[model samples]
Target: MNNINKNQLFWASCLALLVTSLSFGIRAGILGKLGTDFQLTTAELGTITATAFWGFPLAVVIGGFIVDVIGMKKLLVMAFLFHLLGIVLTIFAQGYWTLFISTLLIGIANGTVEAACNPLVATIYSDNKTTKLNHFHLWFPGGIFLGTLIVILFNSLGLSWQIQVAVMIIPTLVYGYLFSKLEFPVTERVASGVSTSTMYKSVTSPLFIFMFICMFGTAITELFTGQWIDVLLKNVTDNAILILTLTTGVMVIGRGLAKPVVHRFSPQGVLLISAILSALGLYLLSTLTGNSIFFAAFIFGLGVCYFWPTMLGFVAENIPKSGALGLNLMGGAGMFAVSVYTIFMGGFYDKLILQKLPEGANEVDYLNATPGSEMADALNLAKNAAGPEILQATLIVPIILTIGFLGLVIYMRSKKTNLIISK
Candidate 1:
């Protein structure tokens, strides 16, 4: 049995994730500011946000292969440095290129944290992989709650956005200190002496392939909605920030309760139910308005709360031989999906605005219009017209995911029966 301090490592991991989540929240809050200050079009802003996921897959994939070789401590040190550097770059960003590069660095750091810590936690708590992973992932939404609260607080105080970004430095430093001098156990795959060739083969197997494809849809459902929530709800509701906070707040509670849910429903069953809820939630968000928006967001939050961690948990439990690389690839795939979808959604919004605008109106003039001005009013009108269509388009992803998970549930049930008979 491993003798290291699991609690310290777990909390340290949570702090690291907290930093990532804070970064995400702060970035979401600043998107409007970025567009205003930089005079960026909606599509340009989308490209910038997409940059946040661009480097993630590369870092996680590379980190997964070498994590066991360099150890978690070293990977974490790299994460700290990248995060620090990325924040500095973001604070000083002057234009699209600078913001893109800065966000990409942060993406790499976020991916490294996921790559190192998921397996670290799985290794430390091997017996309850799914439940523990759910507990570990609680920090994600928890941090979002804190970060959104900070934004709401800071905005009320009239502080600069830089101050909001700077607040993340505190948690980053704390996590760095916690990780320092701590020993990390080898990955379960390495400990079991599973050769790398076998690991490679496991990822290529048909089941893994199916899950990988489903991950794309699941990620699009959760992340595309999340990253664009503020923008999507800007004109629809006055409480966009609170709505964002409330959404993540619901996620925090749901993830905290995941242990019992997993005990009752099996991971596959839980995923199936989550998929159905997610699809329904998205459809509601696309079609409904007024007081019902909160209800839709609540359902969406409950649906996605378990997605990222649960997907990782399923792989950890079902495909133990695939090791850290498997977890890394799963994370990488999700972020990659988000990256593509962000840009696509941005373009979609841009196209819709053009369609809604009156003949001979200038797109650039509307895009760069100051808030409360006539041009800005026209732009908001176009956004209101187009927003529902964009959201409806996003619903396709979750609907597909619902069907896929239903099939997986049936397959797993049959597999379990055969194993019971063999026993």
Candidate 2:
């Protein structure tokens, strides 16, 4: 540990992760603007958003395989360069393809940060990996809180979305400077003398494979819905982005108190309760409206608050042999699932809207119908029903999560003391 500045490296990572999360929050805020400005349909916008998730898994999975050989510093430098390129490309985006490419680059940068930092935090605080991991991950939501507030402020000030995006460059540059002078530690796998081949093989274990699949449910439940919240809940409430700000606000606090919660419930216990609350929250959002929406978002924030970090912690503590590969693959799997789910969720929204329209009636037909006429009434149904209907479809993800976490908690209990404690 000589010459290594743990505090500097750690906060640099928080700031880097901050940049990644800020991108998510800002993109969520501007999704509607991008769609309207580019004359895009919802499906086209979804494909552009999905491009970001697609690039994420590609970069993080590849980084996982190579980080040991190339070092964290090189991967972080890659993230720095990608962040700048993505921002520049997005600010100048002329159409669909340009937006897609720019968002993809940003996703790659986001994934690279996770690839380098998750294991970095785990390596530095070896005695308390899970608790510290949660502390580090608190910044993900903390950044979103800041980003969403920035977006709300920008919108109020009448700033362009481009300027809102460019704000990320400040933190990106700050983290970039901090990292340039800091020394990095070896990954947990390397420090513990685990062989590369063994690390590769460990992720194939029955437990790891189970978590990988479960990750699909947990991640899509949180991310796909989050990225689409502006579009999905817009019909139900005039200020839907406020729900996002509210949910992430709850998440910031929830993650900050992770230690006591983990102590009281154990990691498996935490997953079980999180799954239940998340399911309830989604159900309420699908069913409720008006001021009640904030209540649902708060429930969701509490439910998902501990999910990402705890999932990684469970693997790190119970399956230590899997090491860095396990952690990276776990995070990568979630993003990959969301990549595909976003397209499907978008299609679901488009399909619902189409279904609400009379056969052979396009959106133009609806627009052309005379107000107060029976024909206009037919399309008004689509406008009023589409958002809630798509949210109803999302119920399936969290429903599955509830069952899966239940089984995990029960299994850990039956095993009775070996892996249940999480540390």
Candidate 3:
């Protein structure tokens, strides 16, 4: 048996989760200033921000294979070093390539953390996996709440955004200390002395496949909103910082309140409702003008809050035997899927909005012109030309959510039937 107390395990999980959340906050919260600092086109910045995700899928895939071999303790220590170096390099990135490299390294570290910690948490609290996992994972957004506030504060202080990015080191160091001092539990699935053959078989099971698909759509939904909100809000206002701050604020609140909300409704039910609201919210956001867009963002934030962490919780409860390898495989798969989606969206945004701008029209004009409205004609004369492609691309997310919701419904019904029959 591990010598560590339950409180140590709980706090270690919290600190690890907080680091992940901080990474996201830094990614989204500093969007506008980073764009300005690098003099990057909106399309270019999208690619840069999405670069970290490029490494995520690979790391998780590899992490799953090695986590059991290498042990969680080794991985957690490496996560700190990787994230620290990545953050330091990001601070000095003078151009896009440097930023891209930094993001890729950070992604690997972040992915490794996911691989180690998810399994650790599940094993640590295997008895109440759902409830404990939900509580443990809350810091993912808790960091975002703190991160968003930091962005606002840094702006008020007139500090370099570069410095703000570097500030990630603080939490990185703090978490490193916590993880270093704590004793970690062995993988529960492995601890029972199960054969490696059995563990692999569990991962390949049919239920695992369903959870994978569910997580794939879930990842796309969560990341699409997080990565794109800053860019999307640009359509709503010239005060890009303020708009991003508002969106991040809503995310913080929604995630903070997720546990209570989840207690009332099951994770699957929460996802089902979220998908509908997110789809409706995205449509409203993409089409609305002025103040309505702000409200739309709030609605979208509400819809996205539970999708990511709750999905992790679901896997913990439903697939206790697969352990962290299962969590890493699924979580990493979702992020990998999101990266691919983001790349596609980036290409469409560039071709449809950025590269093909008209001679004199501003992007703001293109955003404000309603579909089939005469303003599009007047606006088309400006600099940028608006196309239906971007609008169509935005709709893909909602379509995905609908498909995912159907899958969840089937899974829920099947699970219930299995339980009753087994009983």
User: What is the C-alpha lDDT profile of model 3 across 161-270, one tens digit per residue?
Assistant: 78778778887898888888877777877787867777677789887887787777767766766666655555456544454455556666666566677777777777
How does candidate 1 score on lDDT?
A: 0.88
The local lDDT score (0 to 100) that residue 244 gets in candidate 1 is: 71
Compare candidates 1 and 2 on TM-score and give the better one: 1
The models' CA-based lDDT, in order, is 0.88, 0.87, 0.72
Mind sharing the TM-score for model 1?
0.98
Going through the candidates in the order shown, the clash numbers are 0, 0, 6
Order the candidates by TM-score, highest first.
1, 2, 3
Task: Name the 10 consecutive residues with the lowest summed lDDT in model 3.
Answer: 380-389
> lDDT: which candidate is best?
1
lDDT, residue 246, candidate 3: 56
What TM-score would each prediction reach against the true structure?
0.98, 0.94, 0.86
Candidates ranked by lDDT, best first? 1, 2, 3
Q: Is candidate 1 or candidate 3 better by TM-score?
A: 1
Candidate 3 residue pairs in backbone clash: 358-383, 358-384, 360-382, 360-383, 361-382, 361-383
Q: Which candidate achieves the best TM-score against the true structure?
A: 1
TM-score of 3: 0.86
